[model samples]
Structure formats: structure tokens, C-alpha cells
Target: MKKNALLDAAEALLSEQGTQALTLTAVADRAGVSKGGLLYHFPTKEALVKGLVARVIEEFDALVAEHEDGAPGSYSRAYVEATFEILTGEARAHRRWSAIMAAATDPELAAPLNEAMTRWHGRAPDEDPDPVTGVIVRLAAEGLWEVLSHTPELYGTARLDALKQRLLALTRG
Candidate 1:
């Protein structure tokens, strides 16, 4: 519980105030825990950042799992749905922005994200009949995710829904 609270505080700090404002002291205060409590879970800022990244991955994986069905291209479909959800949801959008910014600034921090992507894409080959198409769909979704993250209003809600449906369609084997 304390660990999650510390991580949540760190994420909230990063998302709301950017990396410059993310400090162990601030996180400890935000979480209403002592500095010693924070240190118990994360001895360093790097560890806190890594924990935040891991939590994001875990939440994203859970979202994908929720969308999974026993069918060809299930993973691809789930990936598309999960990507859309993360990009559009208000709280998730902020969390993702923080994670992206953190990863962009530090190569070491990107390792876990890269590993998760590899694991997710690796599953595509086995679950998706036309693996190439699956890869393409995933790429398209990722592209959309990137663009939407920056300019969510680029495509209005209706258009975004249409695009999401189209991506889901591409997952059909």
C-alpha cells in the first residue's frame, strides 16, 4: 500500500508539474508519507521513475488483457483498443505524457517500455494469422497514439471513433 501510494504520488507529481517538479521530498509530502517511508520503497529518483514506468506498463497490459478474446488477431485488436483508451482517457493521457517525457530524456528508463513492446509484438506473430498485417495495424495504432497524444483535437471525436473502428477492422483475419 505504501509503495503504491509513493508511486502514485510520484506519477501525480510528474504528470501535473513535469520532471522539474518531481522530487523525492515532493512525492513524500504528496503521498503524506515521511521521506524515510518513500526511501523504503524507492531509494533513488531513478527507482521511482522506473517504478512509475512499470506501473504504466502493468496498467496497459491489464487494459489489453480486458480486451482480449480467443480469436485470430486478438492481441492486435486488444492492442488497438488499449492504445486508444490510453490516449483518450484524461487521467491516462497525463500519466502517459509523463512516462513519455521521462523515457525520452533517459535511455535507461526506456528499457522497460521497449521490452514490453517487444513482448507485445512478439505475441502478434503467433496470434495473428497475417503477422505483417498485424504489425501494420499495430504501427498505425501507435502512430495514431503519438499524434493524438500531442493534438487530441486533431481529429474530432467522431473521426477518432471512425479511425479506431477502422483499425479494429484491420485486425480481423
Candidate 2:
């Protein structure tokens, strides 16, 4: 719980104040813990970043599991629904993803994210019966991620939610 609090503090700091204010001291302060305590959990800034990445992956995996269990056996539909939640800011790290992306400088720091992406995409069917719709849905979801990661301010949550609904509809069709 303390670890999660520290990671949450780090995400809030980075999202609200940008990377410049995400020092260990600042995170400890925001989390209302001692610097030493924070260090006890995350010995370094890189470690904190890794923890944040892992948290994101863990949250994403849970959401995917939720969708998978709901649909029972449709990978494409579950993947699309999960992607929609992510793009629509319904997912936990939707707003704070930039924080993790910014801190993912080192190879080790980036491995978890890269591995998650690879595994998630691997679950996407390589050859769908309706290739056109699948391609469209996949590209649209990827495009939303690019836009969300680069400049999310251009689209408010409502707009993103609307877009997600349309994208999910496409996936269904």
C-alpha cells in the first residue's frame, strides 16, 4: 500500500507538474512520506519509473481480463474494448501515461512497456475474416494512442469517449 501510494504520488506529480517536479523529495512530500521511506521502497528514480510502468501494465492486464471474461472467447472484441477504454480515459493510467513515457529513457526502464505492447498486440489476430474492418479498428486505436500520448489536451474526455464508442462499434461490425 505504501508502495502504491508512492507510485500514485509520483504519477500525480508528473501529470500535474511535469517531469521537472518529480524529484524523490517531491514525490515523498506529495505522498506524505519521508524521503528515506520513499527510497526504502524505490531506491532510485528509475526504480520508481519501473514501478509506475508495472502498475500500468498490471492495471491494463486486469482490464483486459475483465473484457476477456465478459466476452468468454473473442480476442478481437476484448482487445478492441480494452483499447477503447484506454483511448477513452476510462483506464487508470490514461491521463498519467505521459509520465511513464517521459521517464522511460533507459532500456531496462522501457522493457516492461515494450513487452506488454508486444504481448497485447500478439493477442490481436493476425488474419481476420474481415481484414478491412480489423485494419481500420486497429489503426484507429493506435492513432488514438499516438494522439493521446503526444497531446491529449486537444481532445477532452467527452470527445475521447465519443470516439471510443464509434471505434468499438466499428470493431463490432
Q: State each model's CA lDDT, in order.
A: 0.82, 0.71
Candidate number achieving the greatest lDDT relative to the actual structure: 1
Across 1-173, the per-residue lDDT of candidate 2 in tens digits comes to 38988987887777677878778999999999889999999999988888888877787687677876433224555666776676665433343374456456678877888888788666545444455676677667767776666676778778877876786666554
The TM-scores of all predictions, comma-separated, are 0.81, 0.77
The residue-by-residue lDDT of candidate 1 on 1-111, one tens digit each, is 378778778778876788898889999999998899899889998888888888778988999999999799998999999988887675545566667676767889988
Deviation in angstroms for 150 in model 2? 5.0
Superposed model 1: Cα runs more than 4 Å off:
31-33, 124-126
> Pick by TM-score: which candidate is best?
1
Model 2 local distance difference test score: 0.71
